[model samples]
Target: MKSRMHKGVSLILGLGTACTIGLSSLEPASALPWQQLIFNGVQLLQLSNISPQQTVALGQNIHQQVKQNYRLDSNSKTNAYVNRVGQRLAKASNCSQIPFRFYVVRDSSINAFATTGGYVYVHTGLLNAVDNEDQLASVIGHEIAHICNNDLINKLKQTQLAQGAASLAGLDQSAVTAIAYQLAVDLPNSREAEFNADDKGLQYMRRAGYNPKAMPAFLRKLVRQSSAPSFLSSHPATQERISVIERKIANGR
Candidate 1:
């Protein structure tokens, strides 16, 4: 019994480290061959209470590293546009108490990603992909949902617990931060996380007065391509995602 319990705990603890390092699934369950469960079960370990201040400080660390690798979009107009859209969605998010910040990357890839401390990055390519503001809001809303859902904090806590609680040993602060940086800039979240983001993002879209269907519409356009777009490289988006999201829209949840 003791050995069995320890094995279960270890698996859950490992998810935090795996999520942080940007190391995750490649086995798709259904329509998407790329999707897989990072953990053995659906349960995410929320073992610790990470205060907003701790997350903000860690987020700053992660963001500093992000700026070093990617060039920020220099266009004042583009900067304002993405931030403007992101800010509006933040108000409708579950974690509205803290400020949300958005940045635009100069790269022309259809990608957007978020990190702790309410920071989200949008690619110029993604901006060009959407037909209107509502589409952009839905994307940003999804990112906001990631941050607001305590997904970031959960990763950090998992990393800590996997190492040890009392000694403050293991990966050390800098190593963990480095892993988290990669997670923000270049990784696919677990399938469960992706689904939650889809669900909550729609709610935020409706609350913020953006067309709720815009998310599914935008997504359907992507899947129609002869090949998956660059956006799917970082996200686990699949046909299953679209079907589930559409159902949510119908139910108005």
Candidate 2:
């Protein structure tokens, strides 16, 4: 398949892992192709050069790093609410077949971010910033759009771990940390990726029954906030994002 990797997704989140023995050792049934495998009752995919099993393994490994560094919010009610909203948007997304997972970080920063393998993190401050669930959906949807479009995977392809790093086998931890840091704190999405995620995320929220205006509204709010969240610092300019999203909404996208 032709790669559709784009530049409209935010690259912010923790990703690391040292375990891949389990995933790499599994052998597909004789009746099935090597690219297809059933694990823990989930069907894996092999989109582009990365297999779905590798994707999940990569996600789990990074999740371990995130767990080590961040306190995951355990408020069942709050976490459940975020997951519910996320699932709704996932169902409306183009890559709905991918099992999307959402988690809440205990940090007070008004931000949300995603990494490869359908993992998305929403900060506690972000939960407090949104006026309603629709706005929250917009944020989550944008992150999901990034994963669906394989934006981060493309980023990995350009990094030192460019060759089969998704397998998480024999990968250098220090290198992974460096790449993750660059993604989270240094690398901003290309202007095209920002616009594409905004447009796709807006559509996702709206298709999932949210007000289409919520996306741009939330972006505008971020732009005007006295203490703009780190999210703005790492994404395309908020004003430019707002303009593009508003134009798309006005044009009936």
Writing each residue's lDDT as its tens digit, candidate 2 over 112-177 gives 878767789999999999999888999999999888876665555443222333334332433344
For candidate 2, give the lDDT.
Answer: 0.68
Q: Model 1, residue 196: displacement in angstroms?
A: 0.4
* Predicted candidate 2, C-alpha RMSD: 9.7
Best by lDDT: 1
The 10-residue segment of model 2 with minimum total lDDT is: 1-10
Quality of model 1 by C-alpha lDDT = 0.71
What lDDT does the true structure give each of the candidates? 0.71, 0.68
- Over 1-253, each residue of candidate 1 has an lDDT whose tens digit, in order, gives 0111212334434454553434332222332111121134332222354457556766787777777777888899999989888988999888898778899988777888889988899988899989999999989999899998867665655465444433232333444556667555554566778888999999999999999899989998878878777777556657788889899889888
Q: Which ten contiguous residues of candidate 1 have the minimum total lDDT?
A: 29-38
Colliding residue pairs in candidate 1: 27-35
Cα TM-score of candidate 2: 0.75
